[model samples]
Target: MSGTLGPAPGRIAYAELDVFAAYGSFLVQDDTARPDTSRAFITDLMNNLVATTDGAISVGTARRRILPVTLDVRTEAPEDNLDDWDHVTEAGLRITSGRLVVSTFDYRTAIPRTTVPPGDYTARTYASGFDTISDDRIHGDDAYRVILWPGPTVEPRVLKRYPHLPIPG
Candidate 1:
């Protein structure tokens, strides 16, 4: 679990941590360290955005795009798996029930000193189970984009359990 925030389900959503933690691998020279980086609160606040690719929850077809603040992903799975993330990502809501899990919209990267793009580059994850995400999920205040890459982290364990069912190639 990335933190206590992730396990609840849909209320306070979270992505797998490896993506953001990887940032630590980069070493800013002593002189390069920004004053802001020294503050623990600022670091905590940016952690989620840094971890997310685009910032929105995506699934088979990115099933849940506009999430309702009322529905908390923190405690439960979707009632029936729907596209609700689009609503919340675009419109931050006063949550009452479920939590939303959005890694695509929430994740971000820093501008490397190199010629590459200053911030995180878009790289989608590939999966057979999920449908292609819609443009709505790619835009807005808390939205991001990721090309699907083949991996257990992307595919999820729920769909891979059937031994008879071959994993997507």
Candidate 2:
């Protein structure tokens, strides 16, 4: 990912290509593959990389725009004994403009929609943690996250709000 991160398809492609190329194994094709073994790998490598990367693109005479904002949910804790938590994700909206990029995990993407404009968009993300001994008792954090990425210069922000989780005695 670049210094600035968002949902740009081209940037994502470039990033993924850099990552995949480092491996060089995923690009290799079968020995019996057509006239050239590495043909398939080398031919559509860029397009393949772009296509495989999550997000859409729109190129115009003036400028190009990548349409898609990845909604990701990850554990904030180092090694919490929280299991069976639902890191639910849903399609939020699409953002265009700038060379911004955004990603948390080593490999991750989410449902993307091409509706709405660039601004603070609320996404549906929640997680539940339960007590080790008692199944009935629960202690969890359900968050309401808003992604703020208006433009390139603006600092990307993920404001999260955790609702109260009642524990059953």
Candidate 3:
């Protein structure tokens, strides 16, 4: 089965979260504690593109302002579109609860619960516009796409990396 949620604009203004695993049975309610934004943590997050703790699985962003984001769930892995993206990475995520909620760092704006059978899955995150990302302005071209499919947990890998983007650590 395949499903997609949003290429619509989101409320996230930070460069670290475009989509994340929500730790609860409900879509809008997440009971998981937020991860610390330490130098090591941020470095790991940016390098892998997907970072997970017991509480959450976060996908990093290339832009630090509001941008469109999309989430896709598939029955199998999709081909990586490296030419279309500036950065691409993959990681593992286990969903004990069938509810998959895609949202920003804050829960204010979120995609409704996307149901997938509870299991381990691989999440591939694709990001674009890192080359033109700005600290002082918002560029509408920055976007993120996260695709998840059922699979064994594996070490995170960066398929494509943009050298100019800063890694916290």
Candidate 4:
């Protein structure tokens, strides 16, 4: 019984070639992979390192702009994004409860449409806790946060919602 971040999954760690290609970026000895046992070992080693890095990329969103359309479509209520689509990662422990505040985010991605050769548009809006996330990550005496608009929906959705759990009653 094993999985990621724990005991090895299984015997004979089989892997795909693309995994090797992906980790090739971290190689120090350029063009040094010989076609033998060494190749498989190097690929797996590089992939392991790539999985540990924390770098990430995000796209920005803009204000919603209603567009004139032929087909009829109405906005529907979306579920509260308390998980993945938005990030709610915590790193440290706190000893107190804080204020609660919620914010909204809008996402729009417009490009060439498939049917409409010369027209395309996209828009979305949702509540988030970006501020809560930022505040939680702060480990300093003087803590503060500035609101950011048109940011990636997942980046700053929650700010300070979940306060520290109280002692057992």
Candidate 5:
């Protein structure tokens, strides 16, 4: 995920990664080689995961799997909601218990520079999901305008399994 962060109400972009290892991840600031400006942090939960910025004139380019990792076409839209809000499976997967491992790399070198291991982050699920990423938060901090995009599923898996299984004699 690549984007630019502007002044107050800065955009915080994030990419959800579902990979085996954290070998390739990076962040570039101002389109220049700003050492240490890049960082990697994972959320304890899968909800509301984000990449933070300092609300400055900076550009960030991240390489990894984006959010909304999987969408159930059959159940894409929830019944409770009537606006066709897409349902994300992974979000609920870790909500109960799990962590979203994030690895941030240096944009200049495009190499894994930092690894935000499990249990170091707190992912917050937005009420509007991807659509509300840009909306300002009501409470505490509102300096950031988040933008989230669900990148193509990596190694897509079967989210829902059939209930019927014939017993083999």
Candidate 6:
């Protein structure tokens, strides 16, 4: 085994990324320090997420925007087209406790901590059709994907950025 955490079929996972009005973001953190929601969406407009630390990464979203998110765990880096997504960001995640927790800023809806071998890994988040979203029509207009693979730590990078989306302050 490459120490990858395999997908769980039928397991419902959703994180209300925009839980706090001031912080429009969700969390993908290991068993480390408490998530600093105040730090959410503060930097990296292009990437739309911030790696608070090696153990935590906050993914940005529109205010009160809730969309289905899929988590794909792979043994090695997967091939992806940067142009296919409106925005894409990559960062490193350190899982020291052998568990990864995905959740909202408020911790209201947390997918149970997933078990993985303690090690450094890479996380890439992809978003599509987000600029087309409007209040009258939200669902199905946008999509999100978070992929993880066994790898060494790396600095966050924005593979692509949507031009129309407003940059957070």
For model 2, how does the per-residue alpha-carbon lDDT over 116-155 read when each residue is reduced to its tens digit? 3443222232222211213332212221122222232222
State the lDDT of candidate 5 residue by residue for 71-90, as single tens digits: 11111212232133222111
Candidate 3, residues 41-90: lDDT per residue as tens digits?
A: 45677665556654356666644444555666777677543776777777
Arrange candidates by TM-score, descending. 6, 3, 5, 2, 1, 4
Clashing pairs in 3: none
Model 4: lDDT of residue 80: 30
The pairs that clash in candidate 6 are none
Model 1 TM-score relative to the real fold: 0.17
RMSD to true structure for each model, in Å:
16.9, 18.7, 8.2, 23.2, 17.7, 6.4
> How much lDDT does each candidate structure score?
0.22, 0.22, 0.56, 0.18, 0.22, 0.61
Worst 10 residues of 6 by lDDT: 1-10
TM-scores for all candidates: the values are: 0.17, 0.18, 0.69, 0.14, 0.19, 0.72
lDDT per residue (tens digit) for residues 1-169 in model 4? 0101112222211111110112112111101111122453333323221111111111111111121111111122122333322212211111111211111111112221111111111112211222332233322111111111111223212222323311110
Q: Give the TM-score of candidate 3.
A: 0.69
Backbone clash count for every predicted candidate, in the order shown: 56, 5, 0, 13, 6, 0
What local lDDT does model 2 show for residue 18? 17
- Per-residue CA lDDT of model 1 for 50-145, tens digit only, reads 111121222222223332111122233222211322211111111111222222223224321211112211222222222233344332222222
Displacement of the residue 158 alpha carbon in candidate 1, Å = 4.5
Which of candidates 5 and 6 reaches a greater lDDT?
A: 6
The prediction achieving the highest TM-score against the true structure is 6
